[model samples]
Target: MEGERAGMKIGINTWAWVAPLTDEELARLAPRIKAWGFDAVELPIQAPGDWDPTVAAELLAGLDLAPAVCAGLLPEHDLLADDEQVVRLTEDFVRHCLRAASQVGADVVAGPLYAPAGRTWLLDADARRATTARLVDRLRPLAAEAAERGVTIALEPLNRFETSLLNTVEQALEVVDGIDGLGLALDTFHLNIEERDLPAAIRTAGDRLAHVQVCGNDRGVPGGDHLDWRAMLAALADIDYAGQLSIESFTAPALAVPMSVWRPLATGPDALAVEGLAFLRGLSAVPSAKNSRS
Candidate 1:
């Protein structure tokens, strides 16, 4: 499968062209995604029943495209909310995501699982400690449940603008520490904004890294920005990360108002996916060349 996929298992998130990916959209995009040489498709679980897992499993199995799930946490689904009902609802939603991932043959459910995107609050030293304790209490059971379902909960650290809970690798590691089924999901976009050294952060994730999201610094096609892709990929190799590097840009209409992605990331979302895939393929060839010479 690695050879057939041109070295690494590259994927594109459905969010690149649509939000809350629908049954109709998945049917439309799955074939084109496979045709574009993506080895996998990342299905974003925005709401339960936005898309059917059984149908998606059948569709993706037929096309031979691997499936992955990205948990989309809305404002109403905050695990750390003061409202107990909100927290309960969040846990229920995540469990649904786990079941959905298992049904769709996805091993990892990746996203900002601690809080909703764009949810920020002042965290003083004492508050930070309290928050970490709260997070562990909230996530420990979910991690156990994920293990039962054969799915890993990959907790992603968003940028400061998007979140205040876990904005760095160290902070994220702290939250998931000692948890059996929890792992880190890193993104180049957030890394570019928050990390002092990109490759170092990737190395820091090491074996706990369950998933990776890649895109240009400006949220365009990767390799179209100034990020050092080769160095980052080398760090992944250093850590022996053999997983998918998913392209995760968003379409203007879907996330422009909130994400500030008013300008076109590429000629179109399709161009962004195709160009990012080509660039990643070129990078994957580098190690092959070195090995051939050796």
Candidate 2:
């Protein structure tokens, strides 16, 4: 991973192309993604039949591109609910996704797997505590299920606007405290909103950090916004984070409602991915002075 892509696996999520992606679409998209110099592509499995993992596996393999997965936890799929049936159905969904991830040869399935995106409600202190406990109880078995398939369920925490449940790295760490096969998927777009100190929060995630997503603070391409890429890159290096840094963003007309991505974020989706890739690849390209320069 050192030539054009250095010290990191730069990737783009298929959300940059289309949501609820289809095998037909990926069949056309995967090869172009490889030509763009992305080491991996973050495929989203929105539902059971949205795409076929085996088809995706063969397509990605033919192009020599690695594959990773992100799952959309829709409103109905609730692992943190007080109701047992909701939890049961949610666990089944997660297990199905883990199997899909394995079939696609993804080492981890990453996303805000705890609750549905953009679905939030207020919870008082007692309720919050109870909910977290319930979540841990529900997800422990799912974590084991993931391990059995040789994949990890990388839990992502969204902003308060999207989810009040686990908004910060500290909170995500607390929920995954005793879980054996669980990890965190840190996305810079959400971190820009909730975290006061991005670098410190990344360090706090430390080893439990399994995956990373990079984008502008405004959800534009990375390096085109005000985020401190220098410090963020340094922190990731300090923690020895080896997971793929997928460029996650949504296009218009497709995810406008769920993601609120109405306008065009860049000239086009490919432009965003290309610019971000160049910026990220340059993160460790230029070495600082005084290493042995005295």
**Cα RMSD (angstroms) for every candidate in the order listed:** 2.8, 2.7
For residues 190-255, what per-residue lDDT tens digits would candidate 1 score against the true structure?
999999999899888878988999999998999988998877877776677777789998873777
Deviating ranges (above 4 Å) for candidate 1: 1-7, 284-294
Each prediction's TM-score against the native? 0.94, 0.93
Q: By TM-score, who's the top model here?
A: 1
The per-model lDDT (C-alpha) reads 0.87, 0.84
**How many clashing residue pairs, candidate 2?**
0
Residues forming the 10-long window of minimal summed lDDT in candidate 2: 285-294
Q: How many residue pairs clash per model?
A: 0, 0
After TM-score superposition, what is the CA distance of residue 231 in candidate 1 from its true location, in Å? 0.3
Model 2 quality (TM-score): 0.93
Candidate 2 local lDDT, 199-262, one digit each (tens): 8999899889888998998798888899988777667766667788999988635787778776
TM-score (C-alpha) between model 1 and the true structure: 0.94
